[model samples]
Target chain A: MSTSEGGDSPGEAGGGPDGTGDSGGLRTTLTRTRAATALTLRRRDSLSVVTGVTVIYLLGYLWAVGDLAPGFGGYGLVLAADPLGGLLRTTSGPLSFAPVALVRAGPLAYEASLNTLVGLGLALLVGLNLGLTYLTRKQPAACGLRSSTGVLAGVPALLSGTACCGPVVLVALGLQASGVILTAFQVLLPAAVLVLVGSLVAVGRQVRPEAMAAASGSGARGSDNRE
Target chain B: MPRLTRRRTLASLASLGAAALAGCTTDANTGGGGGTVPAADDRLPLPIEPPALRDAAVSGGPGKDGIPSIDEPSFVAPAEVDFLADGDPVFGVARDGVTKAYPQSILAQHEIVNDELAGDPVSVTYCPLTGTVLGFDRGATSFGVSGRLVNDNLIMYDRATETWWPQILATAVPGPWNAEPETRSLREFRLVWTTWERWRGQHPETRVLSRDTGSPRNYARDPYGDYNPREGYYAGGAPLFPPLREDDRYGPKRVVMGARAPEGAVAFLKDGLREAGLLSGQLGDVPVLAVHDPRYDTGYVYRNPDELAYESVDEGVEGPAGITYAPDRLPLDRIHTFDAMWFAWAGFYPETDVYE
Candidate 1:
């Protein structure tokens, strides 16, 4: 029943230089910390790349929808209003050209602020992925969470797509592009909210199960061995 | 990692500053009323020879008093008089040792004419602004009488009526008595007679008349019909016209004649014109004869209301000071319709013997 034979073998302990119990314990702790840090870093890096790519994709969708649709359709009011909506709009229909389209619509001031905010949101998503990836590194079954996180990250961009669709269209057709930037900001707001939620969940999981259990269990075992 | 470089930041700031400065500079003459200039060629054509008087003998000579004079000749029919479309002809009068003439033709066009003649202060006055003519006699103690021409059709007051007339045209208004008359007094009428007198005194080359020996009257009754001499006749009534408001009276009175003054009167007019931007740099050095007398009441005649009112003082008063009449009464402010007055001195040229 004990993990010492197979599940908790010497190799599983991530072997240390000295064979003493204290040394093994210390080595195990160090290896776990390093593994967690590496996993977090890798997840963060991937998330950053994914978020950045998503922004670029959203921009394309905004551009295309704005160019093709008439009136306020290009502004994508629905996408801008909700995070999921923005992501959906970006991924859906022939309106995939929003991002690139917004750039051509006007000068830098119109889009720079909203784009910066979006870029920040995407960065946060990368951070979240790093945390989640670090937590599940030892368990392959939990690896599926990465794809779900990615999908969730896309929701904001989709919502931004819908909300900004109308103004984006106007900007594409030689109208004021500032409207699109403004609408995009509204759409991306929900993404910020979601990122906050993800951060809280990650912190709770880290402290509640892993850190508390390890601290109490180690304390009791030490007393028993001494007795 | 390296910090951002200062060189790039400075270059960006400089470009922005340059762009802002460029937006402020604009052309001055790009808009509104200043763009258009009036055409100078809008004057009537001049006539060659003015018409002659039918009864030349009676109206031609000077009276027994030695001043060049015009008698009350019968009013000729409008057809008999060859009216020039633009101007009236010059008339002649021989009196005393001098013979002087007035060119109504030129006077009609200019309305106000100035000149010097025959060693005497004379002016052939007409107010083109109000279409009134009077003879100013400066020889009689600097106060003249109203001359009678064509059976009193043209009356110029002499020393007798100096105190009662308002010289400025704008000051004249038609009152209850002589309000609705067909004729109105010209504000600048004094200039015509004064110009004639100046010509006579400066240039004896035209000796039309010697100084008259008869004593000039200080006051006289109104001779024109329906114009009462007593009941508020002359300036004895309320000011025939209202005082000029401070805002409307832009500048001080200009002395275009007589002695030169370093300040006071001259400075007053100069300051006014300068503020208006109408001063032409330097003042003209012509010696203008400034007569600050109240005898000339330059007024207008209004047809609707029957009254003799003074011209408003809004425009500087000019003309023989004693005559009275009004033009029209405006509705909004209840102000009198005022006109311009021409006051000048006329004299005869002995060599040419005609009033030029």
Candidate 2:
């Protein structure tokens, strides 16, 4: 959780309660990290591409599998893995960028797919958060890291984890979270999703298309490792 | 960190609200009624110390019908259930000469199978949590999960009256019939858990419940963790929720065969039956007999022939021709009996006798 929302909604956002009022620190860290990312935030190849992919993924995932539990059947998310769970499956094998819409994914299928999608989103955010923070520290002011919103942007990923992963996390923390907390963890995803969208837009705003074009064309390409 | 604080207090209060809301969600999702469901009320007439001790049901989680029940279930002949391994458990009921077997694999998901046997409408109810399979005469009505639990036992509701009936107690409580003379306990029948091979062999004409239950279900995939060898959730001592009455005389999860008489109830350890083969005992003033059928690996209770009102009719092969079974075959006048977890049986009927 970014320190921004901790005080307002303790368990709604992220991190420990003691971390409240650290938004300024979070901002300081985000700015410092965003400044170093080699991939320009708004570049046709960087944040823009990621934003487009994320948007498309969300739309397609919901379109195909959303009906299984419209608004999650008022349960937020479910994790169905029964083989008789009909069409939507996410437990085994590699996943496609988009899930195939089935006539009906049954009750269990809806739960399994939601868990998979949310779980995968969390993993990606963690990786992006770590990789971006590293670049900011390594080459300050050189890459998009200083202006990148990935760290704050990825805070919503905790909501995704909270949806299906709250119990495991809380159990690990040795905290006997109430059902309400567990439910809130999943219930708050829509709000977290909204926060995520805003962060993506902010990240996209920082992309300097011109700088990205120049870096790509000139010998400066040596300075930017695309992969 | 003092174990209580404003944040903690607010959080606890919020959680309580959530639990109540969860009950509402269960009510909404299950479509059983139009009002909010009280989370854990178990004030049934029982001998337990705490008549209704319970935990608040946490919601925003699986609600009633959230896991779903097999209301529109379909069945198959013996051939379709060829997948049954030797060790698998099945609940078999023979009535009016026609016999049917319900695999635990199927029961593991949908705990209630409302079907007719020998033309008699019955609800074959199983609660994996308590390890009980009880047959109830629906009396032309149907039963669904009330989405409530008493001592972690399945609380069921009849569609007609919407009265909540805890499966173990088998009586209506806290519903429209709360003040009624006697809690309407459903008339139970003989339901034995045995091997599929033995059930099919005893009555090869037996129709096994099918996986094609009109809904997409992993008929083979078990929702509750594996209990076949008791190496999963069944292997542990933890219970989802404790029953109101607390007793440790029998392990909470130990399987015990129980029978109730007009006077009181009694239980026999499965091992006791496995060893004794045949044991005669008295429940109330009436004498009862407990026998172990090694072929099916189950214990059966019946009224002792000496005290039986009449002789159990003998039918050569099938049963008494029509939909009624020949009571004389096993010669145990079959009564509504269940094999339940020791803790659950003892929790509800603390006055029950246990055969060592």
Candidate 3:
């Protein structure tokens, strides 16, 4: 699903048609990233990668945030008194939402919240980044995307999970919480998303349609990479 | 059982007048066990004004009811429980021939357990940050974690009136939900903060709170820290949030046997009470006695207005008449007391008299 290498790199060396530099390049990179991300989703292998990573990351995210945890052996479900109203209620932090329902089965229990949606969005972004990274690796010499980009972007998202419970993680580590640290926790989720999206663009802009097509003996798909 | 209506306000004003009168008496007798605090009602002295305390309430991560209360709490016998270690802390309460234990591990996850004890509704609350466990008469409505803290203590809100009541203070303060609560206090009871082994050994037939709380939580994992060995937040010198007031006389996590009344507050160092077996101090001008229970390693505070010189004997505490009495069964009027972190006690009652 990768495009062939094109010498026309967006952010690195280009100027806008009107002569704007960095902003124009960034816009072009984002445009190409959107196309590349869509292409990665359309392919079976990359789609599997996206799905697998998304599921694993979402589970890990829920576990870290304490929404999904081990339960006493049981099979039951419980809903909050006002589950609908609970959907939008904020809990531990700005982004953390209250659980509206609890679903327990066998060894695991999950508390349903708007946080699951938040985590799903983040997990999908992480999955797409890794999926693109996987494509780049398939044509190693032909691509400049580092394999570590997706992994690095995912770390902060995991840390943001602990952000739900204030300084709970800090307490476990025997670290004192300060105003600066709490402020950082409030921004961790948003920062992680921005970094993941930024990573996707950086990796996507490196793909050259002609080079990738020539390497794989297929027609060039650069123009077709657009929205 | 009355709402925060105008009539209650008038009643509170009358009570406050009586408290002021008692305060005047207390001011005259400032030395050893000498003054008298108003008789026990629900009211205890507030360190500051109610409005100031309301303004000081800060978010402790979760929102109102964010940390769910065990509204329909269930209990099991000692042999049915396997989650608690011998050294693990348990909040033990005995009332009207009924004895129960709420494990610290479970209470850490769910701060308030609304249950009935001896046919009376009560809420067993534990605050991990302040390291305090208290029991309150819930009456018709249960209490929940407001997810708010003042001076690093839990600010509980009654479900019926949505009144903000700080767990340590046991007094109502205005909050956003109910801006003009009558400033009344909740009836409080003492819960001995002792080890599971100690409580179970003392009350082998006592019922322990079941882990089958309706909420889906890993009771094994305490978000703040552990208590059996006392590590993480429980043992930390610095609190999760800044306290309302700071005192350096004792370590922040140091345990103190604290009690307060309409007149004033007093704290006896737990270590001091344990070593001396009996410590004497004055609360606002009223003399008080603290007796250590060797079995539970806990202490009870009593208003010693008669200036009784009780001594700790192998059998129990020896009163003025040389009659031996159990630590918890003293002849003097007992003041509801509980174990609290030194920081929490000092932060809530900065003017508290300390018996080191």
Candidate 4:
């Protein structure tokens, strides 16, 4: 998959363990980076997931905060049944009047701030997972499997609704705060980001290209160029 | 009831916001204490006598302060409040040379300002429903609305004690401290309910409260109605909530200069004060004076430190005893007076005497 300079110059770059068939080292790395970057941008399924969460949160947030702040007044994405009514009821604003009632309602800002943060975090976390496979195409089967599993493990955290002050609320709820949701947020976000970054490292380390093996051996009685 | 530890007690108080304290203990009501305000326990004194409280059917609405009290109130130079109409009523207070005005137009939205005036902490409060504007020296504790109302008046709670202070009664009604032996009521300043133009014109360097309160509100418009034309809510004397006691000597919401003392309570009709800047009367043997300060457009009630006034000033004749005097020329000994709607005053002070 590498269109690296090693494909042309051959000897100047380091070679892979696959002998002459290995794509050149630095060239393979650049190829991997471009592939990963492109894959991240092109993943339609992943993009839809991020976009979906954003749209849903925006619609729900607008409906819940309706007519509270001066600019935030009015229905959004009109769901006739007002699916977010339960969310709105949970809010403390007056339901009848628009702006005034919104003023009277409590926690509209708090909820909105937290909900938007959670939605965006989900978008970034999901995007990282989708970008991993193309960046680690040297062992496509293994990397793709890891990416799928990591994303599945993460989906629950995004859905848990603990994205904002959920942990504080969880602590407040004590036994009632879902332990699984708490663990997912506390552990999964970082783990997912790390896993995605680790795939890039694997590409650089394992996906070496051919040709350079015979040439620049850190030279000096070296039996093999790479340990 | 479950045993409540300090932790549990403190934890329980997390639910009440500063604004919620305004509605508590009404014809009385109830709620969550949150940390700053202790939960109302049996320890509070039963300071208010019966008839001082009545259930106001329509619970207190978050009159702009639902976002909560302005623990930190911001103020600007009097000239900054250029939008104020000359007739827009304001609650003006001058303490230790510090003169400040709280415009009804602005306060109608916020309802309470928990701030420090001079060196003493103060809470400038207004209840549009009750049509009352008053000020309190918080001592050290701040007041938050418990979101409860008694007799259509705002019930405020102290951050230290969730003890309910119904706006008109100024007495801690219920909660943990209600049964304590001594009734604790803070001294309220006599906030002159006058116009901003009149207040600023008189106190040229006075500072006016800025409407930039963090809370969201339409400061220019009054939720109850406009006071300039004296229409809408003020049009007729109608109580939003049924009073504990019904007294029709005057319309339910008639404007009056109301006062409270260790001795008793009395309300003077604004009509008499409008004509005579000074009107002296006796309630339960205590000679009092109600002086109208036209500059602030507020009527003041004073305890006649002048003992001879009862005999010297005309006692029975309505107009004869009202010695002509400027509102500013009031005697040194002054009593705290709050301008209130008759319905709220009557409801809280049912045994209160009517001074026409």
Candidate with the greatest TM-score versus the true structure: 3
TM-score of the A chain in model 1: 0.32
Classify candidate 4 by CAPRI docking class.
incorrect
- Model 2 vs. true fold: TM: 0.61
**Model 3 TM-score relative to the real fold:** 0.81
Candidate 4, residues A144-218: lDDT per residue as tens digits? Answer: 223234345445434333322323223223322233654554454345445544544443233232212222223
Write the residue-wise lDDT of candidate 2 on B190-285 in tens digits.
787887778887878888888656444344445345556764445556455555556677677787788764445667777776666555566544
**Candidate 1 wrongly placed segments (more than 4 Å):** A1-39, A42-114, A130-138, A141-150, A161-166, A169-188, A199-227, B1-356
What is the Å distance of residue A184 in model 2 from its true position? 8.1
- Across A1-227, the per-residue lDDT of candidate 2 in tens digits comes to 02232232211221223234568445533442344243544233444444554554444333332223322011222222343453433211112111222232333333233444654464444443434433333333333435445566666655353443333234234343454665565555556666554554344233332333343433234534332
Candidate 3 chain B — worst ten consecutive residues by lDDT sum?
B1-10
Candidate 4, which segments miss by more than 4 Å at Cα?
A: A1-227, B1-58, B61-67, B176-182, B305-329
Sorted on DockQ, best first, the list reads 3, 2, 4, 1
DockQ of 2: 0.06
Leading candidate by lDDT? 3
Cα interface RMSD of each candidate: 45.6, 11.6, 2.9, 16.9
lDDT of each: 0.26, 0.52, 0.76, 0.51
Model 1 root-mean-square deviation: 38.0
Please give, for residues A4-43, the per-residue lDDT of candidate 3 as tens digits: 3343433442342322677776676665666678767765
Candidate fnat values, all: 0.00, 0.00, 0.41, 0.00
| Candidate ranking (TM-score, best to worst) | 3, 2, 4, 1
